[model samples]
Target: MTLRPALATTLALALTVTLAGCIAPAAPTPEPEVSDGLAPFFEQGVDWTECGEGVDCATIVAPLDWEHPAMGSIELAVSRIAATGTARGSLLVNPGGPGGSGFDFVRDSIRYVASADLMEEFDLVGWDPRGVGRSSAVECLDGAAMDELLFGQWDNAYETKAWVTELEAAEAEYAAACARNTGPLLEFVDSGSTARDMNLLRALLGDEKLNYLGFSYGTFFGTMFAELFPERVGRLVLDGALDPSIGALDWFAVQMKGFDDALVAYLAFCVGQGNCPLGGTEAAARSTFTNLLDTVDAKGIESADGRALDSATLGFAIAAALYSEENWPALTSMFEEVAVGESFIAFQFADSYYGRGGTAEYDNNSFDVYTATLCLDDDFQGDEYDVRSGLDAIDAAAPLVGGYFAFDDYAHVEAACTAWPYAPKKQPGMYDAAGADPILVIGTTNDPATPYAWAKSLAGQLESGVLVTFNGEGHTAYGRSNGCIVETVDAYFIDGTVPTSDPNC
Candidate 1:
């Protein structure tokens, strides 16, 4: 139950949009056309009425492919929460899935994520980015297929060609499924197009500037926004910022190391606590966890959940679970429980890492979109040797723990893009965008997902970007905890106050 997928804390390595004219300034493109074929899905002919409280959902068409605007069109589903009370402006919030749903993100966890105060001042905006929830999504491998694949024995017997074959089959099955249900939407889901959609939303929102609050990969969405329209950036918060410079392999490898770091952090916390089952020695627990992985690899364990636990999946599960501190206690409990008599602890971690669909099957979107975005964005070598090298580094960085993190899992994203049905338009600054106002960036020291190094990279990349550090343990900060973090963020939003210096939370 490590939940490192939160990838929020590691982002503290640091701390840590755009524009348009208003008031009848620009001419309307020849009237916008309905996104081809997928128009009905986005317009939601099923529900003519908008879908939320104080919100309206609609379709805005942009070129199916930005590069060939006149040739094709694609529709993005959008939702907006108009300003209530005294309004500051439209604040678009993204919950970092690359595949995550932003539609209801504002209310997902108002108390801990979007502060009540911030909500009152700004009109909350959320959307199911192109190929994500509520928004027309990509679904090749449904839940049941994913469940079967999730419990497979890859982490341990990966040494065998059978497991490698299994992984290859799974990867292909997933890709084919996407082709069946997703059609050409995959081409449009890339971050750059999403940013264009954001601009359109900003225009429709009638906001003078784009006020954005992006979490996890959402940070990249925000950065792209800034680069696209630097003048339109209002108050922006990037939590668990991603390192646009890193390739997918690097992202995966670094994330593995991030988990190791957070795991040690958890061990240190457990060792000192009187209730800690691992006792008060983090180093001992570290050894214990490693030994458990080795033990499970050799002899699988049974959990209360009635599932047989092996090393690979457990490692993957725990690595994912450690992304946020909120998941730490649960992780510790599971590890302790597994040590005692239940192997089901691994299943618990799996459930959290990959939530079930309404049909009781797990969603593979994380695995899918994760692949789509990273693959499309990075120049993946697809060379097994190159990927193995990164994985080896993770393994060396932290023995028993890094193997799961190895970047070789599904290195095909980039490879697939090579044969993508359509051409791709690499954004102007897929990684580097220098010169601009100080972009206040926040990174949670314990973030397991995006990791702190990403924050540092982001700060270093943006000429005017300043790094703000949050000492807490969570996925995204600002509203997650710490009054100081909140105040600093609010100032940036209201007064354009970039931290005079990086504030270490």
Candidate 2:
């Protein structure tokens, strides 16, 4: 294995049973509802009770579908770590998953996600977006069904007629499943709607302005917030930002390239080490990994649990390891095991990436919400010619991982949203928050998920955005061990200091 950059890198019937259920309420607070349409949501108080050490958990109601305020409502799970010192205001944080669990992020991983200075000065708040974990989630397949759909093998290659048909079928089946299980809430999980829900939460929190820190997909949510409620935006920091201006195909292509570049960097690092499993040269390492993928594609390896580790799973495993340099040693061990005909570690990596737990159950509904939100957000052309063109570009840009990423035997981008039932409610385009306060956008030079270019593009797109460059590896930059990056971000959030000019660290 290689290391990256600086060693851091059914019909409506089903809907009845599932959609009728409500999320188990946490402590409830009594607040009077006003006559306004949004009053119930805004005036609703959170009955916070101690959940974990120094963490309070609560749930608030937002309309299941905002468009029809009279319709039913959904409960959003929220968690907060109260400020130790004088609180400036609420610092709403999201870990980025058009599916990630902000509730868990704050409740369990607050120390990793925020700095001591931040924890001391702000009430760190995290909420599961509508149609996500703990929130009124979009229920779909059961664990076994999901395991099969997500991890099972497919029989066609990209650009092939069969491949396109199979992918469209899978997507259609997925959409139907969601529609059957999620009811009216299915269409309301879009980023724009979530941003609206966020605004209501802000009001409920008694904050006139929204202060947010969003990472990865959360950046998209932050962008939508600034665009929708520019005046309400306050101290927004979008790290590993996404460029809303780009279409889905373009975004996927760019991400593939980023992962490819990271792979090469990892290969270089591995070669420098004495006992790299791949080979001595970067090219040699690429060739070795490519060959390994081919081998897996032809005859999938068997995991200790007896599950088959196909090329698609292995590819995902490798990509997951590239997210951070801390995982580099694990990747090396994975490759070592794979070399000896073992694939349990590869499956483990893939499982971790998908948020799977040790008992073979998913920890949350991240994947379900991810697909639902993305389908509702991006417009997919699903044109075969366009798919082939995108595949060509990806393969040319990233030969080592491109095949696995764009067209492996299992899945391809062309098939993703083609058969989705809902039309894109949130169109992909530029965001210009002209009247908002300064927003800080941080980008890592070799970020595999949200490429650095996106940060630059997002910063340029927002009239008041300032780009902060971290010329290093890994996904998000702030609070990940870099003192310079940490200090700059802290100053902005704590002292209201915006970088006079773009700063490259």
Candidate 3:
């Protein structure tokens, strides 16, 4: 809801922290058989050098276009923390942005990435998938342009033709900027291409099969990997799974409802806290939030940096806070300031969501890559009329945040991909991942971004998929949930222990 997973935040921190005191050099993995054209990429040598206190980093080459190998080449940044004990094998992890930096995830937050037992038993590997950070990325507008695109105030009424035209114009300019900046690479950042890249990483790492832990959008990426190479999966754990089979607009509608429900849950908790700034009753708290949005919408609050805090930015601030209950107090604090006409706290949350620095520059190319991959991955169907009709349903389902999710307007369902240059490459469908080893699919009951129903849908779709439910809040379950989830995930990765039944913790 903070766009992607909250863990994917580009908050800069010192990179020298070490999870384990010692590091052991890993024995090189064997190369896998591949066609002559890809042989070089698969057989290329890797030089892992100390990049962090206890982590080694390397850059690998991947084909820019898998269909035509000689088209060009791109670099993939990879990092790993060697197991504290004898390693079972390399366990690849992706922390859920179609654009999240797995390279940063492992290198910076090794302990937060996985449990002690799992890290002790396996070499924890992370990589920036193609079109993400530290890889051959999808660049669009620069910092000032991006800030204007994301936070610039719009005055047109959302449902009007003028609003639709303005939206399309902005996106067209955005798409053109992406094309000008990224060139041919923007067209090929689809999930399918990234899946191929994942397989390449697996072969170069010398792992006979891929052992994966993917969260949120990472689940979609992992599912793509499994579908492409069913027989090559090894103990895949997809937490906060996504159902790629759903259409883009429909998925948006359902996810908005999930976030709305999470907001209600948060309101209930806030009301029970006695001195909650929102209100003493659930209904009162809902009104308090809506009042803040109305107040901000009527007269936008300008931050010291000159960006106006409109309903759109305030809505993102609320959505970002709903990603976890730990962030609930931040939401309360944000409201407390808004109640007094202050914009600083809301800007703090929204800027963090966009990874905007104090200088108004983005820390990473996440938004650019997120847009490219999203538009390229799924075909956003429907015309303006259809989008208007769908908005009715979304608004009906999620009265609180529905308009925000749809840009507070009734434009076409293709909001993000409106003027993108390329059509979607992925045909939404079921992925069985046949013949793969047992795949663990985890779902948190109240996860605002990737809903629990999606996890059930994906698990039911995969042939060897096993569902693990966490009855809790937040976007992901593994490493952050209860002991049952941590132990269940660790046992599967460390000892290949698959639960016979759904451990609905």
Candidate 4:
């Protein structure tokens, strides 16, 4: 199983249903005065065309290599809605996939992503980062190859030499496909480069400083921006933050524990509901769930499409639902359907997580870019022995969920990195964005994807960080969370008001 990093469910059914209202496109803005190697990129005008009702779409060009502008350029897809009221500046947003389509987020789900107040005061902008949808993306497998990669059966049992060899071979094949298809672009898709791209966008958009709202993995992107151009920071809100200092193994371990804890929390709520499908008690529910997983692992259930519903896919479905409390009822429905030997609901959840469609093609290149970006951004801090020890620790932290994540000693995790064609471009370390404006960092106490500890870690690391804590569940806190979180964040952006202290809501 590929243990990907924390991803925000901006495309979740609940949020995506809320369509952002459009406004008349504003007149073209003039370019900022600039003279540098990157000046042409900043001075180039964006030719915006109305793609939707009042939403304008445009493409901006940035250097493929920031250090050397002569290397060539890549196109970045951008979309925006003009402010209803007079605009202070553009409010750039990222829904956080590392590969999430910010352009789609703005075009489709702006109301859900941003508050009405903020949208009225500022032009809401979204863009697909490098190697993402609608931009210069990383392409590897087609639908059939993707299905085999994500859901194909493994005949071998756990921990054997056969299993290890098979896993390593599969990872190598995938890496080779990425290298062969993506070419040199694959090496520069890391968050560090993306952050540089954002700065260029900020300048091209005619904003004096960046005003960004980044969720989940976008938090890392935002932090990288802050670290790189501390003086250019304006109003930045990083919700569901990731601690950039942590290495790959720790990222896996904490993510597993977070999901495990979230599962426990869900069970606590589920058992109290009428006709709860799992069991009467949390422990009973866990036992029932594990048994179900074991049964699925041992003998998979065949879906109508003839695909097997195995333990790994079930785990993905579970993780997908755990992203939001709003999705808990869907989890219960999945459990109920699977109990009756129906894999439809489970498959639906898993497919959404993977961005797969009913047709052969995927909706986007998220899965491909997710892996590519991760391999480049992650710091493999140890060798094979250290990796083995780390995997054991992960299993210990999440005794129930971790097993589903791995078959045995997960040498495959490290093996994938070892076989990756490119070296990691960004090193893992603390980012103290000194000389920057006060940045608001928000964290949910029980976020399944990005654990709450990461928020505290990031907040402490930033020299001008002000933490807004939400003592609740789910992946992010700003839009879906309580009034305290929404108000704190909205006030920070709309007005220049930073919280005096953590509300601890």
Candidate 5:
């Protein structure tokens, strides 16, 4: 029951908003001269055409490898919903994934992802970063092959020699598939390249400075952008901030603890509601979940579609449900069904997390791009022995899921990248946007993906950062049912008011 390397899916639904005010239109500023051999990208124009209800779709061309402009180019899929009233400026939004489809987010889910006022005032802009959905995406195995890869059964005990060998083989196979199908573009899909592409986008959008709302991994992207182009940073809000300084192992360990704590909270709430099968006490709940995992691992139950509900898929289903408290009821139903020898609901939960369609086709390349981007970004260089040595402490801190998460060879980037075709390029370190204006950093106290401490660290690192705390549960803070968090964020974006002190809602 080793965790998959796709923990980013927990924060994949992160949405951001920027408020705009009606101001007299000024003449568009002259495009910045493209230094560093980015002249063609800087001078390109987006041909916007109506693609959906009130949405305009276009493409922006960028060099496939920014470091070598001679190596051809890639098209970035872009979309925008025009402001209903007078426009203030473009409000760039990213639904975090390192892999999430920002273009689809704006074109299909803008109303839910943004405040009505923000939508009205600002032209909501979204684009798929290179190697993400609708862009020059990273292609890997076909749908059926991916299904087998992600949901395949494993019988060996986690951290066992057999498990390590099997998982390593599987990861190597996946990486080879990505390299075979994705080609040289895979080497250039790191966040550093995406950050530079964002600057080109800013210039193309006629913005002298960037006004961005980034969630989860998007926070990492936004932070990278500010560090690279600090003088151009403007009106940036990073919700569910990921601390760029942490390496792969620490990042996974911290998130494992966060999910463990969130599960405890969900269990407590479930028990208080009566008739909860997981039991009344926290210890009882833990025992029940552990037993369930053991049961699934020993003998998988049959799903409605005839797929096996093995421990790995069951663990992924539970982890997916823990992303939001609102999904607790569904989670309880899944557990109840599994208790009664049914596994359809449990499979559905896992499928939703993996973006599997009704016919078993994947909706996008999120998992592929997530793996590619993380392999490029993470700095793990350890083998299976190193992974095993760290498990005791991880299990001590996160008693329930840590064994499954921490010992999984697939979760270890080094295991995957040791045989990967491309070498990782990005170096992990502290980011301080030295000359940036006041930036907003939001953290949910019980955020299951990007932990609260990450937000604190990122805010402190930024030269002029204002921390806005949301004392709540879930993956992200904004656009939840918290009026306090909403009002504070909206006020900052709308009126340019940075809170004098750290405000907790």
Candidate 6:
């Protein structure tokens, strides 16, 4: 939330398949004076026009509010690669971003990463979520402004009353910036609506039950689906599942710890890595990292993208890179560059997280929707006192990255939501999958993004959540080069047979 769109989960068996009847949300919040109701533009209906070779483009017109499918429609962009040889029906795949672009992701990645076995059996379908990517995207702030707000600030301590004051001010600035640019769609862009949109995709695909593979935050989407329509889920792979119940503060704080955990493991690996500067002794790496941040803090470094890298920026870059092992060498190499007085790694890491390249542009659906959903689902206590406590917790959890910065983030999203358009429709049980199936929950022991412990804790909560542990690092377990994890997920999808016991990777 304060950082990125990340992914986990647990479950019990005995799922009584039934759609818990539900109605749509009430009349949409009236447009505020600032609301310049810019009705979105998207083409609906199936067409084979956009696919490069075999893909097809179709749009599903979903309700701006599912309660009133007629009130207004959000056109979800869809892409399909029909079953290559045979048809086991359409297998819908969602890449983890709560704000991830399914259309672009599948169009680009499906052909590359998906195993040939996966391709031959099921038609791959990817759709951009409610107000993300090609599906009525939400943009707030110019690319530059977001780069400033999201990555510019630093120092995690928010303990003092004075710092809390600064946190509020910074949050106000960020919220005001978003409120200024993001339009009408931000109000109704919660995960529930996105879930309904998925169901529509199910209907459009003409599937008796939805066969799905949801990674990272997409796993939460899968969980929401199972909870909303257990009967509809067919051969689901909720990989890298996130526990919806954790508050933003808790979720992010856990993420901070995840990074700390990952950093330790990374350092240990670095000790073995010949070129590791911060390798053998964490004290040395810690000092090197701190000094780099301090150096950048005192005098910013010009990044590859030509943006100045401050301490906070460098810190986020470091955190983002450590999310996966693929990025680990890059991260170490980046830091190694810094160790040698080069700023390119700083720029690269920043580019990876902010998605800023020469050709890259601003799209805040991820940021806006991140805040919109988190601010509500997190169920924050707006009390300044409570915030102080959370700040202490962050500092306690992550002394290096905690204190004011994280606490401010915890309190900030909800700060503007004080006057936000909507309220939480469901109770703050974001992690609860009531009558759900045997959900497979995986977490890397040293994961920096979603963190592993939450996975363990979530396993304890869900009815049939089995915990699969990866004694490694990164975001979701699926995409990483772990053959064991990939095989297990493939098997689960092919034959509803979960591993007899959680395997150690």
Candidate achieving the largest TM-score: 3
Q: Please report how far candidate 6 places residue 179 from its true position, in Å.
A: 4.1
Q: Model 1: residues >4 Å from true position, as ranges? A: 1-56, 154-156, 160-162, 302-307, 357-360, 381-387, 405-435
lDDT of 6 by residue, 39-120 (tens): 2211222444444556666665666866654467676888777777887778888876566667766676666656666777
> Model 4: which ten-residue window has the lowest total lDDT?
14-23
Encode model 5's per-residue lDDT on 1-505: one tens digit a residue: 1222123223234433332432232233366556657776776666776666677777778999988898989989988988888878888888887788788777767677578878777888989989987899899889888777776665576657787677778878989999999988999999999999888888778888888988888888899999988998978999888888766667777887887888888888878888888877767877898898877766658776667777667776777777778888988888888888788877777777667886669888877887788878764443343445556556666767544544432354446666678877755355888989999999889987788999999899988877889898887777764887777778877788789987799
Q: Candidate 3's residue-wise lDDT over 163-256, tens digit each?
A: 6667777877888889988888998888898888888887777788999988889888899999988988988999998987777666777788
Sequence-dependent TM-score of model 1: 0.83
Alpha carbon deviation, residue 504, candidate 1 (Å): 2.3
Instruction: Give me the candidate number with maximum lDDT.
Output: 4
Model 5, residue 459: what's the lDDT?
92
Badly placed stretches (over 4 Å) of model 2 are 1-35, 156-159, 358-360, 381-389, 407-416, 426-429
Off by over 4 Å in 3: 1-3, 6-12, 16-33, 381-390, 408-413
How high is the CA lDDT of each candidate model?
Answer: 0.62, 0.76, 0.78, 0.79, 0.76, 0.63
Which lDDT value does model 6 have at 254?
Answer: 75
Q: Which residue ranges in model 4 land beyond 4 Å of their true spot?
A: 1-9, 12-36, 381-390, 406-413
What are the per-residue Cα lDDT tens digits for candidate 4 across 1-505? 2323234446433222233434333333344444477777776777777777667888889999888888989999999888989999998998887778888888877776577888889989999999998899898888999888777877775445676678778878988998899888998999999998988888778787999999888898999999998988999999889888877777777888888999998998899896778888877898998898777766657677778787767876787778889889888998999988888988887787778887556888987777788778874423343434665777788877665654421344466666788888855356999899999998899987889999999999999999889999988887787888878888899889999999897
All candidates in order of TM-score, best leading: 3, 4, 5, 2, 1, 6
Q: RMSD of each candidate?
A: 6.8, 6.3, 2.9, 3.5, 4.5, 8.9
- Candidate 3 vs 4: which has more TM-score: 3
Instruction: After the best TM-score superposition of candidate 5, give how far the Cα of residue 101 lies from its true spot, in angstroms.
Output: 0.5
